[model samples]
Target: MVVMMSPFKGQTGFKRILNATGYSLAGLRAAFTGEAAFRQLLLINLVLVPLAFFLDVSRVERALMVAVCVLALIVELLNSAVEAAIDRISLELHPLSKNAKDMGSAAQFTALCLIGLVWAIILLG
Candidate 1:
């Protein structure tokens, strides 16, 4: 029997972890420079995270507030990656591609909503 390996999956162990970290950083750079939505969400985070620290909320509430902000950024990163992957596959308009992109957008939207809901409850309740 014969098996095939992905050329991109060559790294292993500690070296793989280092390479993965570098790749993740590069992806973050790319998203920061190229993706407007990511930048917007990051700006929002910059405001919300620090505000969380200053607020009179309990430690857990502050953490929850900051966590939701981070969650939104994570979701935006994922959504951008999905859009980039779909574009890399092909620019042609197709239903599957449209659906994939739309779903990614929806996920980001939901994350943003979660951020708002969590913050409101923690701040106002």
Candidate 2:
């Protein structure tokens, strides 16, 4: 069997980590600036996440709460990536493009629903 390594894996030590960090920051900036949904979620998280720490949750519960919220942001980033890729491919209407975008949105929605359910169950149940 043959194994494939990431092109990024060639660089070792602190410089590689720095480059990866820079790439991540750039991606985050792009998502925040270019995607309205991403921006909205970040703002909402800014308020909700810190508030989560002050809740009466146990350590595990608090971690779970914050994790789900962060998952929503991750899903949104993926959705934005899908939309951007589709737009890059073409600006015209196409069924496949719509499907790709909608599926991305559906994934994000599912993640968000999970976040809501976690908070509700842990806090209210």
Candidate 3:
């Protein structure tokens, strides 16, 4: 069977990197503009990541602190993407659709909680 490729798929080497970076930046912009939760988490990260750098913690602690926040942001992006995909499939209510969206939301919540736990343990310990 023949396979179709993405618009950016055929490029190689430096061109591929440029295309990929453009796509990534576009995704980030879309997330910031379209997803309110993502925008809020990004604002939180803007504060937390800088604080992580200036804290008295060890390098590992700083890294972990920053990483957990980034993880939450990443998870939120995935959650938004999932919600968009499900909505694309149909706007009508369905148990499976509810389950998929709920699970995506749960994943984002877990990641956010993990970020909180990491920050509290590192900053308060």
Candidate 4:
């Protein structure tokens, strides 16, 4: 007879949540240590989070603003990861590496523009 063991057998819901939260915090720390753009976005979030509360925005507008900020940060994090991996594979300059880095930078630029557009629409419309 084979006994099946649950992966989360000993963990309560709250404990699992806390564990996941801690892991996320660690990831953010790693990103900040390794990525300059992540640090900039984090600083932006620090300012925007307080501004969101004071703007007297509607629930939907506030949610949209927060979502866009988070999305931009996420994209920047991915771009940084890609650049790091490319650098790890080869320290020498390569066309593909240049292309990858350029594309990643473009992606971050696009995300920033989207955040601005969303905020403008929400605030003006």
Best by TM-score: 1
Overall local distance difference test of candidate 2: 0.93
Write down the lDDT of every candidate, Cα atoms only.
Answer: 0.95, 0.93, 0.94, 0.88
Which residue window of length 10 is worst by lDDT in model 2? Answer: 7-16
* Per-residue accuracy of model 2 over 12-112 as CA lDDT, tens digit each: 89988999999999999999888899999998789879989999999999999999989999999989999999999999999999999999999999998
Native-referenced Cα lDDT, model 1? 0.95
TM-score-wise, the better of 2 and 3 is 3
TM-score of each: 0.93, 0.88, 0.89, 0.77
The list of candidate 1 runs beyond 4 A from truth reads 1-4
lDDT of 1 by residue, 1-125 (tens): 88999999999999999999999999999999999999999999999999999999999999999999999999999999999999999999999999999999999999999999999998789
Clash pairs detected, candidate 3 = none
How would you order the candidates by TM-score, starting with the best?
A: 1, 3, 2, 4
TM-score pick, better of 1 and 4: 1
Best-to-worst ranking by lDDT: 1, 3, 2, 4
Better of 3 and 4 by lDDT: 3
* lDDT computed for candidate 4: 0.88
As a whole number from 0 to 100, the lDDT of residue 78 in candidate 3 is 92
Please list the residue runs of candidate 3 whose C-alpha ends up more than 4 Å from where it truly belongs after superposition.
1-8
